[model samples]
Target: MLEVRRRGLTTLLGGTAVGWALAAHAQVPEKIPRLCFLTFDPGTLTSNRFGAFFEGLRDLGYANGQTISIDYLSVEGNGERFPALAEECLRLKADIIAVSTTPGAQAAIAATRTIPIIMIGLGDPVRTGLVGNLARPSGNITGLSLMVPEVATKRLGLLKDAIPGISQVLVLSYLADPIAPLQVKAMQEAAQPLGLTLQVHDIRTANDLPAAFDAAAREHAEALLTTSESIFVAQGQRVTELAARYKLPAMYCFSNDVVDFGGLMAYDVNYSRVIRRAASYVDRILKGAKVSDLPIEQPIKFEFSINLKAAKALGLTIPPGVLAIADKVIE
Candidate 1:
């Protein structure tokens, strides 16, 4: 009887040990997915683009360091650092990569074909050779495009309408942006029909801006027109200060960046929508959606904003016709 009891106890202990082992295995946590947001401008942290993305993540049941690990990476306005920044993302074992600028997108593409990349508001992805086509972005990269080249003519017209006889206009293009040359070309082409002379100067950094303005003055540019580059967006206030000093009427890419910063005017696509939509793409990719399956998105909403106060500062009057059409007018 004693021997039989000992054997039964040993068998029960063995079963309990097996159960505990299985329970521990089941309790093992899954690896958290990682994301990297690479960009050229770090100043956009307080901008609408940044707010929309993080807010979207929160709405999608994601909390940083809990459900997902996100690294907000920026080159601090240095395009040359894109490759290094992208490599850093790879080192972090990022499952998904998001880029706000074209250079960032290019670097990410160069870094990895397998890692899915989400691009936000590229001017012309097709022309830039970022992907094969929008419909079937087969390999890895995909996101929102504003098709900025299409609006080149319209932006010029708005500036001309706001300040008549703007024959000589300074085309403030940031060549460091990679896509700025194409944008400058579009503006040059658009200038032909309007009888406007474009003084295209490459603005590489904020320090170079004073020289660019000097070029504008030398070329006899009446008004300043900037491409949809983040450099200008980041340096809007400073640009406007220079414009104000020279009494140079200016038109920019975003409404708040212009009217809010005491600048002339802006006609642009809805950037917040494009940014938030990009965030949605990130969420989808993290949830096991293939980049190839996700189609590229285009913006439908556009905004034309004017600032009567800034116009007053420059001693210019916004035409009644132009003011009537403006979506947002700051007085």
Candidate 2:
């Protein structure tokens, strides 16, 4: 009976060890997917445009630090640093790299053809050589493209309507932006039919802003316009303040939030919608959707907003027709 008890005890101990090993294996946590958000939107993860992206991800059952982890690396509107940042993301083994500019996308693509890239709210991606086809991208690059020429036509025509006798307009743009030439060309084409001339100033940095404004004043420019870019987005307040100081009724691009920055008028892509769409793209990519399978998208939503207070400060009256067409009017 003692021998029988010993054998039974051994069998029980062996079963207990096997159960413990199984329990430990079951407790192991699964690896979470990681994403890297690159480029600039005023250097904050909480920037309104970026917030829209995260909100989209949350709606799709993603939570930061839970199902997915994200690292926001802002290059502060400098594209030269994009490659290094892309390398860092590669080192982190990021599942996706989302960029805000065409140059940023280029950098990521150049860094690795294997990793996926999403470009957000940039000019014609095809013209920029980021992709061969929109319906079906050939490589690992895809996202949203803003129709630059169309936006230019709309902005110039609206500016003409909003500001009477606005023959000469000042344009402040970042010279290093990949799409700067395209923006200039589009604006020039748009201006020709309106009988307006564009006086463009290259604003390379913050210090260049004052000089650009002074040049505009010296050139007798009646109004101001700016290309949508990360640099301008970063300096939205400063640009609006200078426009106010110069009494230059301005029309802006990119986001209507600039109107809140004291800008007179803004006609822009609904970046929130575009970026939120991007979140769906991100989700699809995480779920094994190939970049080549997703087509580059265009901006479906646009916003035209006017700040009545800004117009009043400039001693200008907006036309009833213009106000009627606006999506938002800030009093």
Candidate 3:
């Protein structure tokens, strides 16, 4: 009878231990956070921009495949596909949806109200109606603003400085972009004070590019300025080539790649830095911080890059003042 009781007690104790271990295992929360990254450009995920974002996550103790999973979706400049892509993310039950452009953010906002969205490098969240206010977004959307309208004036001023004698300036922009009209208006207002003739050449499609350049040449345009649209960005090489062919001194926003492709200059926000900063928002949101509580951020640092080679090719001398203030001068 003593042996039987001892065996039964041992068996009960072992069962209890097993049950406790199982309970502990079940209590361990899943550590992996799933992210859905949406962009207008299909190449964004592989570009240095998203690479910076990934690096930022790594800095915050999040690994892409191990601690987190990222789903990349790109519209490839097709705004029509945004809604479908956003819906797909929702169907996958993504923990967070990160968007880079205005259209993509808008789609994400329309797709679902519950899924958190981090808007990166957007022009103006409030003006675009992506958020209620900058200080308090009051919704799921909040991240960094590129300040495109404010910067548009600065870019126009820089172009004027680069080509002081340039009387006829052509503004190349995408007509469909929501921020394009604001930028064009800013350029128009800034041009009045500078005593410059600003002509608007809207490119509705890639095929419209050659005609736009022809129009610029026909108008005797002395310089060119472009809006920061994903279509233009994706066609950076072609734009730079056309500028070179026409010998038009061009100023672009948000792309040093254009300068590398032999374009004249670019003054825009530090894209990589903004994207890295966006990761912090993701980190906070993942940690149970409310999106409305996190204030929208504006880029504090801007990059001014000039290619001396391109400037020399155009036979235009960059002002010493402009060159001195440039953050990066590529030879």
Candidate 4:
């Protein structure tokens, strides 16, 4: 009888160990939340934009596989694919959709009213009807905006001041871009007061850029100013290359392109800050703070960057006044 009791006790202990292991496994989260990243630009995992965002998420106690998984999609500068991509993310039942541009934001908004949508560097969300207001987004969409209109005006003035004798300025922009019309308006309004004539050229594709530069040259444009739009951002290297190849004194809106691709000067909002700021909104949503409760944040960090090499290539001199104010100067 004592031997029988010992065998029964061993069997009981074995069953208890198995049950405890199963319970422990069950207690842990079986399914991680899935995030969908949709962008009009080429969406590589290594893109600095995503890296910064992931770092921000890590700070919030969630890492890949442990808490969440991100499924990314890129349009590769093709607007036609955005709608389909957005719809697919919705069909995949993403917990949240993070979009990088206005077009992508609009696509996500149209795809679902239920899913929380976080925008990155969208231009004029209020004007575009992406959100009702900054303080209260009032919808499933909320995030950071691109440069303010007044900031755009100020950058143009600085460009003219830095490039003395720049009376006629060539403005490069995309006609189909969501920010183009507003930028053109700002350029026109700002140029008129400065006595600068704005020669606008619409570059719908890469092939059209050379012709646009030729037109700017034929018109005797003394300087060039490129606007910040999603397509232009994706083609930053190409834009800087064309500006150099054409030898037009140019200023870009993004410091990344200016520093990386050698533009003479750049004044714009800090992109990493924009991405990191959006991470806060994502955190709030996950913590049961409704997106509606979160206010759409504006850019608090702005920067001015100058490239001395590019300035020398155009035979332009960076004024001491501008140099003193620059946040970064690239040699």
Query: Which prediction has the highest lDDT against the true structure?
Result: 3
Task: Mark the regions of model 4 whose C-alpha exceeds 4 Å error after superposition.
Answer: 1-29
lDDT for position 191 in model 3: 93
The parts of candidate 2 lying over 4 Å away from their true place are 1-20, 42-44
Question: Candidate 1, TM-score vs. the true structure?
Answer: 0.91
The best-first sequence of candidates by lDDT reads: 3, 2, 1, 4
Q: What does candidate 3's lDDT look like per residue over 34-147, in tens digits?
A: 999998776744563468887898899888777888888888767779899999998878999999888888889889998899987788888778888899996788888888
1-331 in candidate 1: lDDT tens per residue? 9899999999999999999999999999878888898987674445434777777787887788889888889888888899999999999999999888888898999999999999888887888889889998868999988887777678888887777777999888888766788778888888878889888888888999999888777787899888887888778889989999888998887665667878788888767667877878988888889888988988887999888888887788788999898899899
lDDT of 1 at 53: 76
- Model 4 error, position 272 (Å): 1.0
* CA error at residue 232 for candidate 3, angstroms: 2.1
Output the better candidate (2/4) by TM-score. Answer: 2
Q: Model 2: C-alpha RMSD to truth?
A: 2.2
Regions of model 3 farther than 4 Å from truth = 1-31
In the predicted model 2, the residue pairs found to clash are none
